[model samples]
Target: MSETIAFIGLGNMGTPIAKNLIASGYTVKLYNRSPEKVKGLVALGGHSASTIGEAVKSADIVITMLSDDHAVNAVSEEILPALKRGSIHLSMSTIKADTSKQLAEKHEARGAVYLASPVMGRPPAAEARQLFILLSGDAAAKEKVKPVLSAISQRTFDFGDAPYTSHTVKLMMNFMIFTIVELLSEVMLMAEKSGIDKNILLDTMLNTIYGAPVVKIYGPLIIKEEDNPNGFGTQLANKDLRLAQETASEVGAQLPLAEVVRTHFEAIIAAGGGKKDLPMLVSYLREQSEEVVK
Candidate 1:
């Protein structure tokens, strides 16, 4: 609560996380490319920064919740130069493990610590402070920041000293989710073809052994075709699948489900459904069938 926290990226997940910080009595500096996006947070006691340097230059801790590897790295360049020694940059982006490792080296060389703190949970869960954080990097830094991380997350799983391990685990976690989404899509279509409502099938699953949070959450989204662009987009979901496959190859691991999921995602993107909400993958699967059963 005492730390001056600079929060970069004000997208869906970032918004709620920053709000939580302000709610918890931290001095929060908010930065985003679209300065207008920070206004709502500003109204909530967050100070808006017109530039990345302005946000991070004096902060004791910086947190990045950017879109992808490129966006995270782009800001890292500006952040690295302006951030003071001993400051912590807690990156909560889902990115490649190698990218996290590279950032760790750069941060360490500058006498700063980089904590790979990829988080799980949708915007709603974040708003509720139910997000799970997969953390790795400096152990001392992890202890120093647990309160800050815990302020917005239900639990933080520390993966030890290697910063990139958390990102690797994040990719794995997303792969499992994508695989579940693929199964949900198929089961939904199968039920639809057999004169069963997708909603009913999902209802039964939720009451039985299949009711994990991903199942409970994505099930309804797929059934209702909730394609809100502000939620997790289809294209970014595909990018994570691709990252999972790439990370698999680096370890000489075989992921048969990844290939199948990637094929479906590519088809969805090809048909211009890339920006749709992830559960709308049902639309892609339905297009491949005899008829889109309602």
Candidate 2:
């Protein structure tokens, strides 16, 4: 018999990941705060549980893809008491390293296993099962969950015994992603101000040394001034940046660029772009330049 899995948090990324698991032949139980969100999963032959506790009660593995530390903490606390001993809880959210470590200890104390397996990819990547997962946990626990991880991600990078390691690495990765967005925004604005067409500038850049998938994928969205149709919303990006800054502060490390990026995102939120795609920062950049011209 196959191991039954429970997936909590049926958001943009989680939904597709669960769907892929079902397709890959896992018996999946799903729970979402918004009950309506699980309806589609039920239609597709997955079971739906009314609560987190009910969802994980009989499962061998539980995966969470919550929004932030608060949600992760709350759900873990709520479900920890109900999870069977020795069952694994895999966290796939971008949270602070300290929180991940604390959760690991807390869950382990309850005779349950915890693994930090934060993923790197957007919704599209999740839908395609092309995500890169960073995992850190007990070797045995990691091995047991490998099949489920394999179903949702193209590759999993194991960081070994320390569960919080994956969370720290995820924060650093997001810091780089945010920095790229900020730099792209500023440079695009500079080019536009200098009478250069945004698209042409992006094309030239893509043909040069600095070009990569990040630029190739986000450049057009930035240049077109299309802020709607969110892939990854600004609020989530801001939350991750704040977590990264907090992590740096705790370690006595200076993250000057991260601070700047956080401020830029905060300003974008203040300007009502909180619900927009993060690439919308380029719109903020263009507006600032236009104001300078006035």
Candidate 3:
């Protein structure tokens, strides 16, 4: 018999990941704080649970894709006790490294395995099963969930046995992502201000050194000022940046660039762009500059 899986936190990223498991021939038990999302997943042939405890009671694998540390901690309170012995709790959320360490210890104490496997992709990537998973935990537990991880992501990068390792790497990646977006915003804003077409500038940059996925995929969106239509909100980006700052402080690392990016995002959220996309920081820049792009 196949292992039964419980999926909690059915947000934009979690919903599609759970759907992929169902499509890949796994039994999925879903739990979401909002009944509507749970119903939607059930409509796709998933089993629903009224609470987190009910969701993980009989599952071999439990995956959480919560928003932040608070949500993950709240759900873990109910899930830790309910999970069976030798089961695996896969956390796919971007959280603090310290929280990951704390959760890993708790799972170990309960005879449950904890894997920090946060992903690096948006909702579209999740839907396409093209997410790049950053995973760290017990080697045996990582192998045990290979099938489920493969079903939901394009590739999984291992980061040794320390569960908090993945969270640290994830924060580093977020710091780079937001920093790039901030850098692009400054240059693109300058391009528009200098009487150059923003699209043309982006095209030139894409054909040159900035030809990576970050530029090719997000550059156009930033240029178009696409809001958080894909579910990656500014507040969420701000939260991740804060996580990076905290991690840096813990390790005595200086992140001057991250600090600048955080300031821009903070201003963006303050001006009511919290629900907007991270790429839309250009709009916030334009507001502060009070200059026409064209």
- RMSD per candidate (Å) reads 1.7, 1.5, 1.8
Model 1 error, position 195 (Å): 1.1
Off by over 4 Å in 1: 291-294
* Predictions in order: lDDT: 0.91, 0.89, 0.90
Query: CA lDDT of 252 in candidate 3?
Result: 95
Clashes of 2: 0
Cα lDDT tens digits for candidate 3, 14-99: 98999999888888999998878888778778999988889899999999999999999999999999989999999999999899
State the lDDT of candidate 2 residue by residue for 1-294, as single tens digits: 299999999998899999999888889999999999899988888999988999999989999999999999999988898899999999999999888889989988989999999998878889999999999999999999888899999999989899899999999998888898888889988888789998888899999866887888778878876765538788889998888889989999978998788887888888777888878888777777778889
Shift in Å, residue 5, candidate 1: 0.4
lDDT of 1 by residue, 1-294 (tens): 679999999899999999999999999999999888899999999998989999999899999999899999999999999989999999999999889989999999988999999999999999999999999999899999989988999999989999889999999999999999999999998888789977777888889869898998899888888888778787899899888899999999989999998898888888888888889888788887855344
Q: Give the higher-lDDT candidate: 2 or 3.
A: 3
| Candidate closest to the true structure, highest lDDT | 1
Error of 1 at 1 (Å): 2.5
- Pairs that collide in candidate 1 are none
| TM values, all candidates | 0.96, 0.95, 0.96
